[model samples]
Target: MKFELLKTSNAYAARAGLIQTDHGPVETPVFMPVGTRGTVKALTNEELISASASIILGNTYHLYLRPGMDVIREGGGLHKFMNWHRPILTDSGGYQVFSLAHMRKIEGDVTTFRSHIDGSLHTLSPEKSMEIQRMLGSDIVMVFDECTPYPCDYATAKESLTRTHRWERLSREAFDATDPLWGHTQALFAIVQGSVYEDLRMESAAYLTNLDFDGYAIGGLAVGEPKAIMYELTGKVCQQLPAEKPRYLMGVGKPEDIIHSIARGVDMMDCVLPTRNARNGTLYTRRGKINIKRAEFSKDFSPLDPECPCPACQNHSKAYLHHLYKTGEITGLRLNSLHNITFFLQLVREARQSIQEGRFSKFYENFCQTYPMEEDHSAKNAASRERRRKS
Candidate 1:
């Protein structure tokens, strides 16, 4: 895998680039729709492709748990198993284990956890995470690193950061020991984790960048921290990372946050926000987000967004979507998923264009003025924090 820097905005930290993978080339400043358990919920591979998705994400923990490695191995890795002929990135399941605090106990170098499925006990170490991802055969594999929680005290944050650095170093060695299960090159990216502490975040970034992984990811953010802090730390880390490789910010997606993160120099991001909120009856538009379940749209025969080119808007009316979601029709979920994913893809595409044209500053200002978010936006992210795995 290789990333070519094509352009960078003079007015902002934003950049437009290309990531050449064995499966395909992924345009940078891209948003990957989360396809946990090998499928993006409420949408098929073809539908996702139609939504302008160049790549998608896979959850190592959930897939490792449900179908088991035997199933995926027998099915010929994730691409053949899911029939997605595009580049795929798989997290090392560290974040999933972090989220399983209730069922997991962290020993020095490993975590012993009970499965959320059947309460079956399993052991996961950095080496073991590399093994799991090897079998999954993703195009890009994220290194295992502990994700520190928000509101963490100084002592705990420092301790977690120390442990995370060790884990990532170990992950690097383990990754080197393995070969790609399929014939494709699997690039390993190191994750920088230090909670909300700036000095620690800087330390973590410096440490991981030294490891010289194929790429770098900013983790442990958007987990209830103020949006301001998230963007600030993201910029700080981006400054420390090498400009030659890709930089990915994990589990951050709101439309506004996407552009903000791009302006911070994040090359890629993956989040479940689009599909999850779509399933919950929310639709994103250039104007703003709207809940279709509201009764006022019952007889309002109009597209979800007149400007959207998604099938949901191109063909169906808001009243029909309102009815479908209100009456629990599955089609509602599919169409909503399609439209929301399309909006996100279109957003990044336009952002890339703006960066290349050196108009990203103007583009961002216009976007902020047009997409007026009035609701408590953090509510969705807060709720999503519980279910966070990879995206």
Candidate 2:
């Protein structure tokens, strides 16, 4: 993979670049939709293309648990297995080992845990993670490292950071030993982890920079921490990383969070918020978020977002969506998911344009002022409460 910077914003860390991959070139400052299990929930590859998604994310943990690596290899890797020809980025399954697995046991160079799927025991080492991602044939693979939990004590965080550094070296050696399969070139990215400690974060960054992977990811944040702290850490880490390689922030966040992180120098990100919330009747818009299940929309005949060009907004009405969701129609879920993904992609595209034109700072100020994340919860709660009162 090769990255070329085209432009940088004068006022913020936001910049635009191009990532040249074998499948295609992905424009930097891009948002990759989560497609764990080789599929994005409620959307097809065609739909993802229509939504303007340049790349998608896959999970090593989930795929490794179900169907196994043998199945994926037999089918000629993930692209053929899922029929998605676009570039894909796969996580190292480190987060899953820490978050989902049961009966977890951490020892030297290997972590053993039970599958959340069927309680089957498994062990993942840095070598194993590299092997799984190589078998999956992802365009970009993340290194295996511990994702320190939020609010962890200083000592615990420091110890985890040390473990992560060691694992990173092992992962690099593993990737170097393996040859590529399925005609896809895979790039490995090292992750920086230190919980909320600035000194530790800086140390982690310096270590990874010396190792000099193709890219760097700021991990172990957004795990139930305040937005201010996340942004602060992102800024510090980005400053410490190399200017040439791409910087990705994993499992990050809402629309506002993306904008904030971009301003702080994150070149790429992926999250489940867009599709996950869409399934629950939450939709995003230029004006802000809207709950389609609200009673006020029962008779409303307008589109979900007049400014949106998604199929949901182009062909369906708010009243129709309200009815479909209330009646538990599956089509409602698909349409909502489509719209949400479209909104997110469009937001990133706009940010890139703003950066190129040297107006990112203005764009950031306007977005925060208009959306005001603090007011989002109150609006949604009031809408739901009003519906209950009427019922």
Candidate 3:
């Protein structure tokens, strides 16, 4: 894999580039939808292609636990197993393990954890992570590193950073010792973990860049940190990364967050929000996100978004979608996911165009004004349910 810088905006730190993967060339400032369990939830490969997704992600931990490596290898790798010919990125199972804190025991270089599936015990090390990713045959593979939670103290963050660096080094060595199983090129990208410390971030960045992995991903952010701090840390880390290599922000899904990260020179990203939230009735549009399950849409016969090119907006009405969702029809979820993913891809495409045409600052300003900044549907849903319960 290789990244070719195409252009950079004069106003912001934003840039546009192309990543040459063996599967295909992924335009930079790309949003990779999460297909964590080997599928992108409700949507199929054909639907994902229709929505213009160039790449999707898979989780190492989930795949290893469920289908196991034998199934994937027998199917000739994850691409064939999932029938997704596009570029696939696999995370090193680090974050999943981190989230399983209660069920895991971290010691030295390995973490032993019980499977959320069946409580079966398993261990993961940096070497093992690389081996799993290699077997999965992902176009891009992230290195194994601890993702420290939010509210982490200086001492804890510092210790985690040290462990992460050592693990990353081990990951690189292990990756270098093997070849991709499916006759395709695989790029190993290192994760920079420093929690929220600027000095530790810089230190981690410098250390990883020296090992010279294929690219760099800004990890350990968006883990309950304030939006301002996440943006600040992202900018600082981008400044430390090499200009020629691609810079990815891991697990950042919100539209506003994407805009800010792109302005901060982030090139690639992955998130489960588009699909996961769609399952819960959130449809992201040019105006903003709207909950399809609300009573207001019960008789509303207009399209979800008049200008959206997605199947949900083009071929169906809001009333129909709302009805389907309320009636427990499965198609509703897939359509919503399709629309949200399309909106995200279109947003990134627009940003890339703005950067290439030298109007990124104006684009950013307009996005800030037109797009809804804060919409906590979760809180709204909670309150609405409470009111219904009282009546």
Per-residue C-alpha lDDT of model 2 across residues 119-196, encoded as one tens digit per residue = 888999999999999999999999999997655789999999999999999999999999889887889999999999
Report the lDDT tens digits of candidate 1 across residue range 120-238.
99988999999999999999999888887765679999999898888888898999987998888999999998898899989988888777889999999987877888889999999
The Cα error of candidate 2 at residue 105, in Å, is 1.1
What's the C-alpha lDDT at position 381 in model 3? 57
- Runs with alpha carbons beyond 4 Å of true place in candidate 3: 375-391
Q: Give the per-residue lDDT digits (tens) of candidate 3, residues 1-391.
A: 9899999999899999999999998998999999999999988899889888999999999999989998988989999998999999999999999999989999999999999999999999999999999999999999999999876789999999999999999999999999888899999999998988999999999999998889999998877777888899999999999999999999997999999999999999889999889999998888989999999999999999988899999999999999999998999988988999998998999999999999999999999999998743544554565676569
- Stretches off by above 4 angstroms in model 2 are 375-391
All candidates' TM-scores?
Answer: 0.96, 0.95, 0.95
The true-versus-predicted C-alpha distance at residue 372 of model 2, in Å, is 2.6
Per-candidate total of colliding backbone pairs? 0, 0, 0
Relative to the true structure, candidate 1 reaches a TM of: 0.96
RMSD of 3: 4.3
